[model samples]
Target chain A: MALRFALLAALYEEPLTGYDLTLKFKTRLANVWNASHQQIYKELGKLHEEGLVSVEDIPQQGKPDKRLYRINETGEAALSDWVNTAHNRPPTRDPLLVKLFAGGLLDRDKLAHELADTRQIWREQLAYYRSVEAQYFTSRAEMPAHFRFQHLALRRGILGMESNLQWLGEVEAMLADLAAGV
Target chain B: MALRFALLAALYEEPLTGYDLTLKFKTRLANVWNASHQQIYKELGKLHEEGLVSVEDIPQQGKPDKRLYRINETGEAALSDWVNTAHNRPPTRDPLLVKLFAGGLLDRDKLAHELADTRQIWREQLAYYRSVEAQYFTSRAEMPAHFRFQHLALRRGILGMESNLQWLGEVEAMLADLAAGV
Candidate 1:
């Protein structure tokens, strides 16, 4: 359901081919949502059938034509309706949390190793998000309205990763102390 | 897949009927994962057929007998193997972020209202998590090993909610200032 709206939101920014939308998900939108190229193409087909989006084909000189998608007024209204309505935060199903919940039954060293690996992954993500912030959002307050709001979503990702890293650090220290009989 | 391990982890503590496992998901396990009752029952059936778990029917008075599930040695080994393997953090799909990303195209007051509602929800959740922490984790060092690990998962939930609430506050303030033409 959210994926439908995510695709609509991406098209709201500008006219894009299905390929361009997939790239947006891989880069800018990676912080918020993820969708495979197949999912993006499938959803675009549904949006077209539902009359929420219209597609135009541009003939290429030496290649297959490109289908560009633009959100119709109905699609903009749908995005507005979804934005105005309040939704409960969806429950997250984390494999690491589940493992930690059952951590007592597992080896401490193995669990700590898992935590370390996860922390490293998050660290790289944080670095990437920071680089984006520095490059594109250095002056968020003065940015055009659309980019301002986009920055908010990216900022949330940065804070979320930071909070996760902090928790991982605390847990790693606790595991160390436990190993030392502290 | 994670759900199967979560159920197995619960049974590792002790055998439980499907009904009892569902209750755990509703309360203590809610922080870690959410599963529909039908999903839980269905997964339990699969685990039984796969020889990962053994089930026994305990007689009851006047009602249908209860089906109790116990993790087998095979189940324990499966859980151990899963725990030892590190997995990349799964991508999160958040409706709030989607709305915020497209927010510039929407009305400001409505977006702010949505933020406030989401903040209220997180505030209540934070309070609930804190209460659980106070009640169950008052003496972390003195707790049995199992409970210490459980506390770590809950603590992560608390931190994550706090981070979310902080982001919500900042966004709301920005929206307010924009409305004021500041």
Candidate 2:
């Protein structure tokens, strides 16, 4: 459901080929959402069938043709309705949280190691987000409207990672106390 | 899938009737995941058929029989494998971020309204989590091992909600700036 809106949003920006839209998911939209290139290509077809998105094919010399997608007016109205509607957040499919919930069934030390590994992963993620912020947002006050919103999404990701790291540290401290029989 | 894992984890804790499992999902696991009462009953039946869970019909006086479920050895081993394996985090399906991504197609004021509504929702969620933490964790140092892990999960929810609220504030400020045509 949201994937359809995501495709509509990307095509709203500009006319882009299927390959280009997939790249945006990998690079630009990685912060807020993650859709595999395969998934993007599949959903684009569905959206086209539903008349929310229109595709135009361009013939290439000595190459396969490229199909570019753009959102139609109906798609714009749909996207607007989705943006305004307040609903429950998406379902929770977080493995890490489930692991923590079931941690008593795991070896304490092994669980701690896993927690540390997860923290390390987030550390790298935070670094990556920080570098992105530093590179593109040095002069955010003058940033165009679309980029400004993009920066907001990135900022959300950074704050989320930071909060996760903080929670990991606190949990690790508890694990130490448990080991000490405190 | 992860929902199966969640069910196994709950059954691992203790043998409970399907109703009890659904209630626990609504309360204890609300922070981490959610499952409807009907879904819970359906999955419990599947788990029993697969031999991952065993059911005992306990007779109740002047009441309906209760089908209590417990994890079998196979289920325990399956859950252990799931807890130990490090895998990809679930896809990020944040609607607010999607809205921000499509802000260009939306009216600025309506976007701001939606943002405020989202922040209000999170504010309520944060309050709920804080109350839960306060009710359950009075003396952390002497807590049981399992409860400690549960506490860690609750803390994760609290921190995540806090981060979300902060991000909402920041984005709202950005929206203000956008309105000022800055």
lDDT top scorer:
1
TM-score of chain A of each: 0.90, 0.83
Candidate 1 lDDT by residue in tens digits, B20-101: 9999887778778888889999999999999999999999999889999999999999988887777777787888889889
DockQ by candidate, in order? 0.70, 0.66
C-alpha positional error of residue A41 in candidate 1 after TM-score superposition, expressed in Å: 1.0
Model 2: DockQ score: 0.66
Q: Write the per-residue lDDT of candidate 1 for residues A1-182, one digit (tens) a residue.
A: 89989999999889999899999998889888899999999999999999999999998989778999999999999988887777777887888888888876667777777777888888998998899999998964577777878888999989999999999988988888788887
Instruction: After the best TM-score superposition of candidate 1, give how far the Cα of residue A144 lies from its true spot, in angstroms.
Output: 3.8
A33-149, model 2: which lDDT tens digit per residue? 778878888999998898988889999999889998889988889998887776567665577778878877767767777787888888998888889999997773587888888
Task: Tell me what TM-score chain B of candidate 2 gets against the true chain B.
Answer: 0.85
Residue B91 in candidate 2 has what lDDT? 67
Cα deviation in Å at residue B81, candidate 1?
1.7
Stretches off by above 4 angstroms in model 2 are: A60-64, A180-182, B59-65, B180-182
Docking quality of model 2: it rates as medium
